[model samples]
Target: MAKIVASSPGKGILHGEHAVVYGKSAVAMSVDLRTRTTVEPINKNVVELHLPDLQTSSEWFIEDIMRIPVTSNEEIEDAVKVSEALKHLQTVLNVQVPCCTDAKQQSIYAFLFLYIEISRKYRGGNFPSVKVTVTSELPMGAGLGSSAAFAVSLSAAFLAFYGKLDKKTPLSQENLDEISRFAFQAEIIIHGKPSGIDNSICTYGGALIFQAGKIKEFLPEVPPLKILLVNTRIPRNTRDLVASVRQRFDTCPAVIQPVLDAIDAISRQSWQLLKEMSNTNSLQKFIPLLKVKFQENILHLLKESLEQAELEIFEAELGCNG
Candidate 1:
């Protein structure tokens, strides 16, 4: 009917960033930064997209998107799989892959998938006309959950537009969960099978423990800590980042698997420490917490070093600033 706007928080992975992709538990906390999306009906019979951060804009006739095809999860074809759907949409949209980075392509693909599939499911295949615009306070591709926040906000906005979400009760658990669910689906297209922690943090605006595609919410026990979020401004595709970690693990499972287990242990222990710190002034558990933090810190340093090796190869391929 009228214009709808929704926003979702960005997140910081306190522990288990790379390990989480391997189905290890991670702790994700919502950050101050967020992404906002607006969806409004248009009479032009076209679906328009505006991604200001990406400096990109496009529009598609509803007729064209509908003709691209739709199917249920159980009945999906190779092209319908979330991983392949973007390429399929790309061929249909006639968007040149050479002109866009993998990050940019995936961002556009996630949006288009959500718009087309969510609209089809919620508003029926009648091809509703709408314009969707996205604006973000988070730095793009800096690994601050910017993509997850974007997806969550886009999902919320589209759901609200199609009468699947309540504008007045956007904060309701039901609405938040629905937004998170759809955002995770979009995450699959972008991250190639995310752990669902980022979208959960963005949707619920709190701390979460996510593993094996299931997320558990934890109370915000401790006060917010002051920390700086550095945006290196180095353009890197998240999928590439994840793939690097996967490649390392795949190559050295004997050595790397234990490291991932250690990381998971660190996350679980830190989560417990947060809960303990929230309660009594007991210093007994504090030492263990410090130890866990120290261990995780070491792991993080190792991860960066490993990633640097991979990045050097990319630098040689794409120049310092591709």
Candidate 2:
């Protein structure tokens, strides 16, 4: 088999950040940046993983790792380090696959999931000892979906390695869906509640308009939306944000329900506007509407997670009219 080298782009949602989890639609764009993974075979029974971007590496004999039990209670860090799928491959193949370790936050788990899935599917002879390298230029965790990008790149690399990238023929829609589905499965190991948007956008680049249960990549449509992202170095926990929103629903339903309803409406309208832009070629006309609806929806969601004092600060930051 030929060595596989694959790369996939980073993605960001223009609307429906957290609200999408509650079955809202969101528009997302694939940036011209990516994570890359390269796989090369060696002569031995030990595979190695190297990640130079993060300046970290770890490796274990394939046989030694297989004996390690898979435990969900052993903390996310440790469980990911010694993934269940990796152990399965090690034990079944009865070989050593040493992983070169890296600090690329998501690389290890992505590699483990893809390796095991491929091994299970082929069920052929021993997989040659290989050297795998993951490298990326995108910021690791700035909410840019770097984790999903890395996972997709690794999955694509393995698909190419096994000569399965073109197994279904001329890039049909079904083939695209299959590729994206496979990538999404690998991403689950890294992102506990992935929306699947990241994996889909990275796997099939360009502009995507995604609904609660569907995703569509629009054709050559370049909208005039001047997207701006605000990063709060405040480092809010997503779980805590969700919990706070739930608490509002439980404790102050009368006050919060209207806001949530309005936000949901905004998300729906935004999705329609994006779809319209894709069809009409009049993207400039909807730019202002897109900006207003997107900002309003996100601002309301943020309010659910903010303290009164923090809300005051946020209002001031957005200025008087905003």
Candidate 3:
């Protein structure tokens, strides 16, 4: 039983959040904050989970987990399959089905979901008894990719424990892809309709442009930018916010579609500016244009809906002097 440890960075949506749900382009970048998972083999025939961020710890007997019917990775392909699997786990664990309403429960479900899936996939019918511990520097439910980072780290740890990962060197592209795929499955269990951008950025790190379920990582020439991640301590329900946006789109597609299109344009422009900035040293020259475009296209659209203080806080978070 090898002791395996892995960590993955959280991510922030640089541009295009709700619009991405409508097949529009978006950009996400990996933040310095990370979630780390460490797996150690135990002599007992039980698997333990310790999550400091959630302030919970539990252990499941390997025999009990093995008693549950195992689904092949191919069988659990889509969200429906993932949901079905989650339902089965809920029955086995005697927990609530829709556990997302509780942060601690949701985090536990995600861990169990990933642990069962990855361990089953790699270790076959023989489940290993391991004590897995996780700790994170990321803020919970801040629209950052905390869940994705957790999933990625767990996937990597499980893979490493099964001797499927390279022990000597950095994870290769192939390894990253596999980790991302597993993390995406976990995301589906949590988010229901994740775009895969969060998992991709967490696995590969740096920045990426994602659109319509496709992701393109930033080129090496593009230097990573230092960013300030300020937690406003403001809490909002993502489902409610998404529903509100969907309602607006449903009611006025003619008007809202153009706003979404403008947002998409801004994202594309920002992407291009990033590329140009990578090639040249004069990054400041594009800041004004980018600011103007953001103000005109995005801020203008969001102005009426967001409170003045909230808007000001966001602007300040973006490092806007105005």
Candidate 4:
């Protein structure tokens, strides 16, 4: 039996949160927390999925998945077909049909979606019998890109299982791109309209600056930073937050637009500082000066853009600046 293991890192937005939605630049970096997927071939013609984080385990015979009669040359070609396949898988597994709010069901659906599509794409419509176990260190629905990490890991593992991966050396750029593409497809199942940055950062394993839906690696040659991920244990709805921001922008463009532009400027400056940090041989010597300048500029911009009441409210609520 062949065994393959692949892992991908979670991500967080360094800057440009709400502004990124409005065609602005955002910086996102992969965190240390990751998700790992293990694929082991089984003698019996069955595909089993074990997602411990979701407290779900399911198995289905390859013959059963094939009997559903859904085929496409490409995995992402037909959304309706994929939905139908998900429904069929849900029925076969005796699981509830997935809704947008149901994270557990959605996760299971994503796993089965990738499993069937990837197997069909690479194995020539012959579903391989394998047991996939996914484990993660990241928390779900925390704006931490946990789902993206899971998707990337699953994509890489399935590709490796299908003999598409080169195990002798480091993964090539082409390999990473393919993995990112598949992961992005899976992400669409979880996030209705994803910006593609999370999967890209997870696949590339570094900092990335995403602008207007385009992604460029940030200091790829430089090693990843040791980031501290402090989970507030707050469960916030991303869609609702985004919608609220949009509504605010629509309601008070004069006020919100300036704040967004100020944030964009701060993010751009931070990106420049990151570039300088990468270039400087003695980061320890330069970081102190850079920090002071960054804070001064950010404060100046925020004060200029926001009203006194707004600034006080922000400081009181966020507790970042006293």
What's the CA RMSD for each of the models?
5.8, 7.6, 6.8, 5.9
TM-score of 2: 0.73
Quote each prediction's TM-score.
0.84, 0.73, 0.87, 0.80
As for lDDT, the candidate ahead, 2 or 3, is: 3
Order of models, best TM-score first: 3, 1, 4, 2
Model 4 C-alpha lDDT per residue in residues 1-322, reported as the tens digit of each score: 4899989888888777667777777777778788999999888889889999988898887877886555444644545555666667667666666676677766777888888778777876788888899999999879888989999999999998888888765699889988988787777677655667778888887677887766854657543345566788888655455565666566557776766676677677777777877876767765665566446545644324444436655767788553
Q: Mind sharing the TM-score for model 1?
A: 0.84
Off by more than 4 A, model 1: 73-80, 87-91, 95-100, 167-170, 220-222, 280-295, 299-322
Q: Count the backbone clashes (under 3 Å) in each candidate.
A: 0, 7, 0, 0
* lDDT score of residue 179 within candidate 2: 61
Candidate maximizing lDDT: 3
Q: Which stretches of model 3 miss by more than 4 angstroms?
A: 72-76, 221-226, 300-322
lDDT of 1 by residue, 77-182 (tens): 4234665656667677777532234666778788988887777777676677888899999987888999899999999888887777754643678988888877
C-alpha positional error of residue 50 in candidate 3 after TM-score superposition, expressed in Å: 1.0
**Candidate 1, poorest ten consecutive residues by summed lDDT:** 71-80
